[model samples]
Target: MNEDNAEQGVIRLLRAAAHTVGPGGRLPSVRTIMAELRVSPVTVQHAMRRLTAEGVIEVRASKGAFAATRRPTSEVPDLEWQSVALGAKPPGDESLRDLLTVPGPEMVPMSGGYLDPELQSVAALGAALGRAARRPEAWARGPVEGREELRAWFARQAGGAFRAGDMVVCPGGQAALSTAFRALTEPGDPVLVEAPTYLGAIATARSAGLRVVPVPADADGVRPDLLNAAFARTGAKVFYCQPLYANPHGAVLSRERRPEVLAVLAKHGAFLIEDDFARDLVIDGTPPPPLAADDIHGHVIYLRSLTKSAAPGLRVAAIGARGAAGARLRSARVMDDFFVAGPLQLAALEISVIASMAASPHLAAAGAEGPPRRAAHGVGGQTPPTPARHDPVGRHAGVGPPAGRRRRRRTDGSRRGPRRGRLRRPALVRGRPAGPAPAPDVRRRAARGVDRRRAPAGRRGRGRGDTSRIVNLRPTFPVVIPAHR
Candidate 1:
């Protein structure tokens, strides 16, 4: 028999066997099915694939096919008791869920907060991962604080003041934020955050059982006056902020206000969690030094991540602090995941080095352009200037004289005045203004009975007109007829 006939025959037999054995019962082996049906192995395998896809059976690897479970449609299980057992704590993962959701193929994502796949350095990441896998100690566990070289790299990126020992490598920025929140504040302790801050940070703070308070921010960054007021009002010991290209707002704290903000934190004797997440994404020019760079009193706890500029899967970040705060963060990291996987840490280190090397040329070029201009509002420093406007005649609006009065170079390389012609005015058709009249050459062509509909794509035609005096008409013309007969 043909292959299709054999497949159908085997499917029918399997259905019968499933009904007899019921759910979770093993069906006949592939060999047995082939022999019983007197069919070739290919036919039996094809039938099995169809059965598995249709939910009639499940083929376990290296094991025979088994009947799939079929739940009764009329009776739904009671999940009410579990809710009472779980208590009344609200679900706190909505923000994270939104962040982690993968958009469908049809979606044009305007808002998920990550580098586009095209923007991520895929080749560098792949190379790093490959090199890491080949390393002798790739699988071995390293220091819980992270590799010394990797920590040193992060320290160097921050500035000359920080040291490798002051840093604790975490799985990612989100984990670093969560660990910092739990280590720095007790349950119900208030944590001050910039109003309209990173949603992930808010979720992490709440998950760590800390109360979040909003401090209003402007173009430059978080308002120092309001920040001090928030500290006095709520007695919040910890403040979380992104000083460089802050999420959502993209505000970089101004040079003048940085000192003021830091002084406020010092006055309140509170810790500032500086999330320097976008240090590498400054496309136009060099960003100002991180808030942690000038910190002398160990007031700044810095968090930097490679996952945004690099690929998403490279979830490596560093948290830098000094004194007891740093110690507590290290302990929290240990308790959280023991240590990040060795291969991943090594891969992250390789990628960081490669990315920094790649960015050096761009940084040098940007340096040559001098520093970026500060924003008038003083919030996000160095905003790009607004583009120049253009006039209807295709010249820059406020630029030197009109296009017709300008000089032009002839084919023989001599400068001559621009050739001027009578500009066509827009015609009023059907009590509405129409587009400008066609040029003289186009009117001559129309006079020769050339079909306007046969004009090239994107060219529009006016209605019928005389050869001598060209009268442009609207595309649609109203027909008038007398009442006859």
Candidate 2:
């Protein structure tokens, strides 16, 4: 048996022995138990150690095992009274728990939101983190708004006219979302969201004491008319959306709906929190520019995270907004955690720069193989070879016939007729053929359904006597079943 099974068995045996042996009663020695159970001495010792730690038994250095005094049932303290002391507050952690749950060894995971371990750039992240750790100011307290260089990098990533001042580096995308929700809306204020949106967003909004209002979405993303109606009906000032390859369902907002969405948000004079979390996860085609990129009116609050693409522990993300909204976000971040760690900021910057540089070749290759190339081939960017039709067995037409068959040469040295089998069977090569020819009487008996193997030893064929017995055993004609009786 395995070590776990052996340990379990030892534990069970010890527990049973302890029940029979009263307080301070000596039990069987380890060697005796080991011999009785046919287990190793080490397993018995380990089990005894565990029981001793549990107060179920005690062991003296040179003496054998003894059962410890058990505590009376009445002496156990009651925790029932704490229910009245602690007020009711239902946990909103179900979504977070589901998100963080690791699949078992036998399971094939296709549910989680992050990349599988194999896809992550482990070497690049390690190098970046190591380099950042060696810096003298790695542990120093950073600015409330994050490092200026990191902010500038995020600003460039956000595109458009956003400057370093407009970016606020938070711990992660979730934290950025929470900060934005709390900073923008008052408690109980309605916040608009897509109907089938990120569960984390809903949880975060509810935790921030905001009323979540769902706006219907379609294959092209959130419907502009419904969003306008939701904003007007609920009087919501903040809307959270994932425009590019949304979570749970990968749906990219169409180009046509972009302007309509912007127009609706502009008309309502509200903020659109764009969670651009899947920017780095693009496997094919370039993702559209972020909503914040073209927002000249400061209506979009862009949040991008590196944790999903890189390692999970690298909890760094950036939020970009303009004017008063950006100031509010910075203030909220400062109030939340003062600032993100300087080493993490440096590491994020290094990783982002290195990842981008490394991705350049892949991006170039993808670009070189444009739509025409992809369409000409199959969807996976390579054309599959067509099968040959001339070969009767469906093997490659260019291959020669099977072994032991040679083509006959004609007068002009040209092959003619089909190839014949050359390899001789043992029976065929001997005086008898491949299979001995059966007798006519045996064939006739077989056709008549006679069991020759079950016939008498002297019987050679279905003679008159066998025929009479077969007729007697045959079923009667026009057979019928009697009713009731």
In candidate 1, what are the lDDT values of residues 68-179, reduced to their tens digit?
A: 9887789888999998999987625453553344533322222344444544667777888899999989888789999988899888887765799989889999889988
TM-scores vs. true structure, each candidate = 0.65, 0.60
Report how far residue 407 has shifted in candidate 2, in Å.
63
Residue 263 deviation, candidate 1, in Å?
A: 1.0
Using TM-score as the measure, which candidate wins?
1
User: Model 1, 1: alpha-carbon shift in Å?
Assistant: 21
Worst 10 residues of 2 by lDDT: 476-485
Clash statistics: count for each candidate: 3, 0
lDDT for 298 in candidate 1 is 88
lDDT of model number 1: 0.62
Which residue pairs collide in model 1, if any?
A: 219-379, 219-380, 220-379
Error of 2 at 133 (Å): 1.6
For candidate 2, write residues 333-388 as lDDT tens digits. Answer: 88899999888888888774334733644323323432322232111212111111
